[model samples]
Target: MLASVGEIVVVRDGSGPEILLVHGGAGPRTTWGALAPLADRWTLAYVHRRGYPPSPPPQQRQDFEVDARDLAPLLAGRPHVVAHSYGVLGTLIAAAAAPGSVRSLTLIEPPLNYLVPDDPEVARLERIGDAALTHGMDMDPAELREFLRVAGAPIGDGPLPAGVVAGVRRAHGGRPTSEARPQLEAIRDVGVPVLVASGDHSAALERICDSLADALGGKRSVHPGAGHFVAAAPGFAEQLETFLHKSVR
Candidate 1:
């Protein structure tokens, strides 16, 4: 069913315990479509973050702080929260605020580079992201492509889709991921079982994920082959299901 969690639009389907699925720059379907089949066993709440259609856009740009405010009220049920890419920033903030309300937290390739800020590769990735968001569509084609590549956006070699372009535009001038300093200690103290997964496609991302896992005292898994779309990687559903099964509240 379609419902509103505060101002955010949410599509909830299936049965059993809820698993909130938060997408990053990509839409819900792009991020979680591969896991739709899991609805047979678990309810999936696909959050339509601000700047996405059906959900109202943010008052400013696509800032994670706005997302955190939007997501805080939705955590009442202690759902297993799964967030990807940029969405992870806000989700982390929300979860940290009410750590006991989260059953388990799974993060996919979030650009929380501050955890490993000294790494040259992480710095490179951060620079590319800043450039892309700063320039948006005005960025040089090659630079934009490089940004998209690091972001795991599946633009391929074809002309950019209108939806994709719009998503990029919405991201223009958004808060940089490095600026997100979620209360990791607060979350860790609550003893939430956190799982940080990476695609193993980028060394920089892997390094960041490693630090995140360590800081959160969470298990880290690398699901190769899907690049940035780690949720769609082969055998990922099974692994996630296993984790969820063990994590159920």
Candidate 2:
């Protein structure tokens, strides 16, 4: 059934302990299809993301917090949350806006770059983003996509659900963008039990996740052979569930 809060496409179902899945960047709900099997055993809420297809029309509040706010009410009494990329940013903001709404958080390559300025890679990222904008996305979306993959944005050749791919094209606007500065600042103050992780292949992800761990005082993990989207990697769900249940202590 559709969730009462956020975009109309927001949905929650399943039984047992609850887990909210939020996709990073413009990827919509189905981006979690590989991980959806977990929902069968655990109550699941796969947020459709504001402004995306299957969601209500977009409002003016494109800022990260507004996106985060839309998902807040869904947490009515939910406990655990799992978010990736931009979704991680929103989840963190949501939990802060209403700390009572969430119990624990698992962030997969959150792009919270508070101290990432010094890295030469960050410089290259800005360059790549600019080039992507100039090159026109579809000209070769794969090039830019791979950049994000290295930066923890997850890139794959598998075609996404049609509506989901369309939603990403609309919401992401074809760029390997940086985190919104204000939102980055807000994350530094989030007080919660968060497990921040990055793939061993993602250097930029490692940098930001390390910064996040330092600021939030959270534990960290690294998935081998995975880029930004660990959920897309084989065996990721098992690792996440194990971490969520045991080491999150």
Candidate 3:
């Protein structure tokens, strides 16, 4: 079935314990390809966050709080929540606001900068990200390709797909949300299971995942040879299934 929460679009499929899959800037369709295999075992709610296509554009510039508010009602019955990249920010906020609204959390390569703000590697990434946010679409072709590579496209030496470039451009305009540190304590207090996973490729992301795991008292997993797109990796579904079945707190 399909539903709309404010301007957000949610598509549901399968039948079992509810699992809300929130995609990052790439939109809900990005998760459809990688996570379709789980539909047999999970009643999945895939959210297309505001500003993404099919979801109406924001009335004004919206941040993570806007997303969290939109997601709260969907969390009814305490569904197991999984989010990737920027989607993780809103998921964390929603889980914190409604303390027991989430049965468990599986975050993959969430760019939670506040977790390790002082780390040098994170600082370097921050600089790169800041630059991209400021000049991504304006960047030269070569520069944009490098940016895409650093951002984890998992593509070969060929030209990037047009859709990928367009997605990045659309995402570059997003406003920054408030720091996530304040919500960490509340999320931890909720006492639900949390699993933080990241790819082994980026040093900064690894550190961020480590710190996020420590904050939530959650287990951590690293997908070999994977980058930001860890969900598309070969064993990702297996790992998620294992965690969901055996790691409930």
Candidate 1 residues 1-249, lDDT tens each? 999888889999999899999999889988899999999999999999987879998887888898998999899988999999999999999998889989999999998888886789888888788777788999888878887887776687888878678778889988887689999998999789889999989999999999999999999898998889999999888889999888865
Q: Which should have the higher TM-score, number 1 or number 2?
A: 1
Give lDDT tens digits, candidate 2, residues 1-249: 665463546667787787888886546444577777787788777777765657765565334666666777777875688888767766777777666566677888765554577788656655564454345345356666655456443346776346434534454433234555434334345455768776777566678778877766778877776455677677778877886676332
- The local lDDT score (0 to 100) that residue 221 gets in candidate 2 is 77
Q: List lDDT for all candidates, in order.
A: 0.89, 0.64, 0.77
Note the residue pairs that clash in candidate 2. Answer: 152-228
Root-mean-square deviation of each candidate, in angstroms?
1.4, 4.3, 2.3
Looking at model 2, which ten-residue stretch has the lowest summed lDDT? 167-176
Which candidate has the top score in TM-score? 1
What ranges in model 1 sit over 4 Å off?
156-161
Report the lDDT of model 2 for residue 232.
63
